[model samples]
Target chain A: MISRLRTALIYVVLGLGALVMVAPFLWMFTTSFRPVAEAFTLPPRWLPGLDSSLESYRRLLASDVPIGRFFWNSTVLATTVTLGYVATTTIAGYAFARLRFPFKNALFALLLVSLMVPIQTTLVPLFLLMRWLGLVDSQWSIIVPGLTGAFAPGMSGVFGIFLMRQFFLTLPKELFEAARVDNAGHFRTFWSIAVPLAGPQIAALSVIIFTMTWNDYFMPLIFLNSVDQMVLPVGIMSIRDPVGNSSATSEVIAAVSLSILPVLLVFLVAQRWIIDSFVRAGVKG
Target chain B: MTSIANDAAAGWFSPQNRKETIAGLLFIAPALIGFAVFVAGPMAATVVLSLMKYDLFSNPSFVGLANFEAMLDDRRLWKVLGNTAFFAVFAVAGNVGLGVVLAVLLNRNMSKTVQYAYRAAYFFPSLVGLIFVAVIWQFLFQRDIGVINYYLGLVGIEPVRWLSSARNALWSVIILDIWKNVGFAMLIATAGLQSISKDYYDAARVDGSSSLRTFWQITLPLLSPTILFLLTMNTIGAFKVFESIVVLTNGGPGDASRSLVMYIYEQGFKSFNMGYASAISLLLLTITVIVTAIQFALSKRWAFYE
Candidate 1:
């Protein structure tokens, strides 16, 4: 009876923590759907009525913010970067995992050490490089860096390689040995043997990279000043400040909510894999 | 590093090593190029740029250690650094503390479905951009209209200034960070908990030791490595934070919530003090590296590996 009571108390605590975590999203959606007046009330309504209107959504669509342009730019930039990581990280990771290389340990150490450098160190020179290349306002600037781990080469890319190396180290050696016995070249061996079996880890890598690239605001904010190239987060910034102005509360909330809808949907579906991947990564180290 | 030794022992290096080296080089070529261009090249230039004064107008003249000396007198630098440092320590503490609690809670006997539901709830917010969180939180943190204040009013407590006030601003950012990140730390902790052998629990039960005693003695020591990982990652992640606070407060009430990164952005881009900004960023980098080294050295005293 005492153990059962303890279990119930644990559930209650977990439930309350969950409530705190979900509150912002709940407030965002419910407040967005409410009428402009109630949305701005001194003490919020907390729950919107069934009479909640689609008025804020309509306003966001009708606004002069060029929402579609931002959406396209974000989609293209994120998609390109995600694909780039999938290819670059997969090969590089596989090489580090399976292939013999000169100065391999030393090289990997350099990558790991670079991870400690803060992103601020790179921003100044990255901007200078972009200006020199005449790609200051171009999407290419974001995409190129995005492919290089989106923040620091020391971070995302190196992380992917580390994960892959750990994973590959676990596989039966006889499998790769068989490929070598077939007189297979390194590329062929990787393509035929390693790539085919690494579907799950690669998928996890893809999903994580895509989510990261999509959610990135800082790099895009720095590189692309043109509205036509602005991504969702920065575009949302330009649309409304969402603070201090009670009048625009509903519309601003609606826009921000809409901005996250695609990623939210993606997360809902991919969350199991995401959770499992984190668990797996943590378990290893 | 152990993995490399393992690979070498596994005969990844053999009579055919020369051929493998060429293939390996070709495979890693793109990553090498990326490193050279993005991190290595920029790092080199950043160091050089830190020593020169160029405002995107004329040739950069070498200014010796003027930029580094300038940081000593820069009041805003000291303020933002303080805020970032405070956030780093406390934000990591909040996340790790809550994470350990949640991990322990979830470890209690429960239906898998319920456990999953609880996890999804905690983790859902982290999926979207911090931009979205900031926007939603802007209203939720509103002084008068916010639900937080409304709830406080119901308890007969006054509505607190969460973002607007200098005193509360950095704390509010820290709160936002803990909320956003505790899910990740919880996930890592859960993994760590699961990896702890069930034999430990069984033996403790056999010895008639209470659950609390077992947790303190076995669980925490076993969790030290994971906790160390969280501390290091969260500290680094905290220093990198920019957009969420930028959207929420823009370092308002006079640099009360500005991070080192935000300060760097303002100096380099807005104020056009690129050289000084570069020097400050190196300082930020130095502080982070030192803190991480200290964490690692400290971990040697208590971290359990088995």
Candidate 2:
């Protein structure tokens, strides 16, 4: 009886925790469907009724804020950066894992140490470098740095390299030796043997990099200033009237909901892989 | 003549060695070049820039530690530092504590479906961008119309000014941060808990050890390394809190919610004090490194592997 009671208690606790976690998102979803006056109603309706309208969403889509353009820019930037990161890390990881060269260890060590430096330390100089290149207001300012792996400590391509290197190290050396005996060059061996076997790691890295670049706010905020050039996060921030007279709460809520839908959908689809990757990374370390 | 002969005989310049070197270098070239330009070069320049006064419009004049000296008297710097430290402490504690509790609850003898559902629910918040988080939480904390205050009214508590008041704004941001991040900590802790051999629990049960005692003796000690990892990462992340502040309060109610990183942005971009901003950034970098080093040193006492 006591054991059964304890089990019931655990379920109750878990259920309550889940409620706390899910309620706000539920509220946001409902409010997006609500009219402006209904959204701010004193009773705080949890569900939209007959008064709920799609007008807020329509207004959000039609607003002069250029929401679609921002979305496109963010998509292109994130996809390009993810591809670039995967390519750079895979090759660098392979080199670090399999190749023998002078200063290899030293260079790897430098990369690891660079992970400790804060992004704030690099912001000013990177901005200046962008200016020097005449790319300050261009999307290239964001894309170039992102593709080149100029990321913050935990979010950097160095972490990706580390993950891939660890994965590559677990592969058998005989595979590479077989390729070399077949008169294969290093590139051929990597492309044929190593790349084919890296499916899981590539999926893991791609999802992670895509998510990181998509949700990134600081880099885009600093680099791209024009309203039309803004990414989603910055663009969302731009929608607010600075003088505080805006009564578009419902519209803003709609915008927020729409902005996160892509990532939310991606997370819903690839959540298993994402969680598995994090678990493997943590447990192995 | 002898050296030349030896060099030729050593095979250092042989085709095989040359091929290996070239391939290796080529493979790493993209990352190396990117790192040198975008990361390393900027890092070196920050050190130089911190020592000089530059305003983007003017040729930078050598200031020779004036920026660092100015930080001594800058009250805003001190305030933001205190705010950041306060945030890190509360946010890290809340995240780790709640994460452990949630992990423990899920790790218990639950159905697989139940476990996955609860995990997904908790993790959903982390998927949204910080901007959305800020916006959603802002509406929730709205004074008269918010769901939070509505519930508070039901419980006969007064509606608190969550973001408008100076005292509560920082804590509001901290709460939202904890809400968004605790799932990550929970995931790490769950992994840690799952990895422990079931034999430890079995032996403890055989020895008539109570569940609480087993948790204290077996679970926490075994999970210390994962906890340490979460601690270091969480501390670094909390120190760099910027987006939530920008989106939620914009350092409002007279700078009560401003973080160190946000302050750096204001100085560098808003005030155009690039030199001083670099100095403050270096301070942030120094603090992060020191905090991480301290965590590493302290981890030896508790974190166990094998």
TM-score of each: 0.94, 0.95
Model 2, span A1-285: residue lDDT tens? 998998898888888988888788778778788876556666766667788788778888777768889889888888888887888888889989988777889999988876777677778998999999999888788667556665531377688788888989999887887776677888988898998899888887887788777888888888899987888888888786532333477777788888778877887787777777877877765
Q: Report the lDDT tens digits of candidate 1 across residue range A77-110.
A: 8788878867777788788777777788888888
All candidates: interface RMSD: 2.9, 3.3
User: Which candidate ranks first by lDDT, i.e. highest?
Assistant: 2
RMSD to native, candidate 2? 3.4
How well does candidate 1 reproduce the true complex, by DockQ? 0.62
Tell how far residue A4 is off in model 2, in angstroms. Answer: 2.0
Off by over 4 Å in 2: A48-51, A152-154, A241-247, B1-13
As a whole number from 0 to 100, the lDDT of residue B75 in candidate 2 is 99
- CAPRI classification of candidate 1: medium
User: Which candidate number has the best DockQ?
Assistant: 1
Candidate 1 segments whose C-alpha is farther than 4 A from its true place? A42-48, A148-155, A242-247, B1-18
Q: Give the proportion of true interface contacts each model preserves, from 0 to 1.
A: 0.75, 0.67
